[model samples]
Target: MDLAGMERSSLVKYLVRQLEHFFPDGQHDLSFRIEKDLDQALARLEVCIDAVKIWRKGEFDYLHSSQYTIFLYFLSNTIWRSRQDKRLCTKLFYLNKALNGIDCFYEIEMPDIFFIGHSVGIVLAKADYANYLVLYQNSTVGKNHGIAPKLEEGVIMYPNTAIIGDCHVKARSVIAQGVSVINKDTMPNSYVFQSNSGALEFKPCSKNILGDIFRHV
Candidate 1:
């Protein structure tokens, strides 16, 4: 897909271009880096689909909501996370920019609807999770004193749980589930997880959701 466009809303185009800068469009350029990124992107897409399902069943007509369209477009990129796979990566970049504009101008905060393992055993807070941040089952990023991390692009959280703090989970980091983070900084592309005890103590996403609003959602 064309990641950049003209007469397609200059502001949106600009944003898309900026986001596209994170990727270099080739395995040679980003060689061994595609697998994990693909996983993260896919994880995000899963949550996005759940959000859409919920939005569709809402009181207001979610179809007419621009937020809804932007969401679909943004999430449509997951299928292309393959390394050097220009197809989906490029599309993802395009959709990301448009979704961003909707978020900026429309004030539409994307919902945080995860799949836990298949969307289970995952841990997350109710705070607004931006588009495309996926968490594997057993992974946790609940609120600490009501503060949770706002994940950016391509963030795939692995199972076993590993996220905490009033920090921005910068784009593209794989938090190996079961890891603990508090008062710490996680840079993009790095990996993090709780110690052995931390991972074991953490419960699966299903266990946490069995009879809660989370499960129902």
Candidate 2:
């Protein structure tokens, strides 16, 4: 059971408890600044949970309890709002690198609404993402040259998939495991998979692409 399914009165305590895993030894205090940070993090968390449909059952433990998910959620939110406070941006920049090993330079454009799976590598140097994009483990969404590609909405990249370099992954497209789509444009509702000979193949997606991931949503 997720922790968000617990009593409403203990929500902050619950979040702080999980946060303790990252910030230990009484460092997870409810100070004004920390509370402000939590408020911003929770706001972004709402958007992510909505995207994944984690809130459909009125529970958010899967999000809040996840170190990778919640950390990336907060990191993205901080980067989005970094322009407001230079000092905070610098602080968050290091926190993200130290905690998650995910390097998102402040200049890179990160979508506020997205879900990240475990061990995800996002270089996204110049890439722009649409809503409802799912990134699985060991996957990379980045660029080859200076130019990065744009991903449309409802794109699900399976584990080890790499979408790179000035490509357009259309809406509702599924990038299969270990498939590398470099400098190519994918059709909407298409599936890009790997052949036995290690070649990339494209076909129409016959099954529900985002259904299993966002099933509850």
Candidate 3:
């Protein structure tokens, strides 16, 4: 049902088709048994966040601590590699479409949210996400280490900004024009901008910042 360079041989595609079959009427019915599995995706996101919160507490027990460390790397790689994975993309595509029918994706049981610019240029390996998060063109969420980052509700990212590591970006946070965040927390009601200094700096998220962000996108 989708076009473009999408590969049918891709696993993401196969699942999407399979999922499409479940929606003969072209609508997602929450009561479908297959829908239960959707919870797994949300669980994965939560677990990733928990891992980061633990490390941030500075509890370095080596063996046990290493578990989350491995998971963190695996997640980062999964998000990136999945972009190359046709199967993953297929699943993501139909998943979004399937869930969209509900008119409230924020309450849905899903993860790995992506935008139209696509899964290819985007990577979100984040651990925590508030409802109503939106990602646009080429944005990435991975890590510099095992830092599990928290992205609050209504956060919108633009093209080519890689938000890496365990940073807490507060609610309604606006990541301004091509900025990257790593290993730090951003305050609520903030606007992030790329300074001439080559790093992302935060200021109160003013109407000016919001207007500029909407304008660029």
TM-score for all predictions?
0.37, 0.71, 0.46
Q: Please identify model 3 stretches exceeding 4 Å from their true place.
A: 1-120, 208-217
Q: How close to the true structure is residue 72 of candidate 3, measured as C-alpha lDDT?
A: 24
What C-alpha RMSD separates each model from the true structure?
Answer: 14.6, 4.7, 15.6
Q: Which window of 10 residues has the lowest lDDT sum in candidate 3?
A: 101-110
Q: Considering summed lDDT, which 10 consecutive residues are worst modelled in model 1?
A: 100-109
* Candidates 2 and 3 compared by TM-score, better number: 2
Ranking by TM-score: 2, 3, 1
lDDT of each: 0.44, 0.63, 0.47
* Model 3 global lDDT (CA atoms, 0 to 1): 0.47
lDDT of 1 at 184: 54
Task: Highest lDDT: give the candidate number.
Answer: 2
The deviation in Å at residue 33 for candidate 3 is 9.1
Judging by TM-score against the true structure, name the best candidate.
2
Q: What pairs collide in candidate 2? A: 53-217
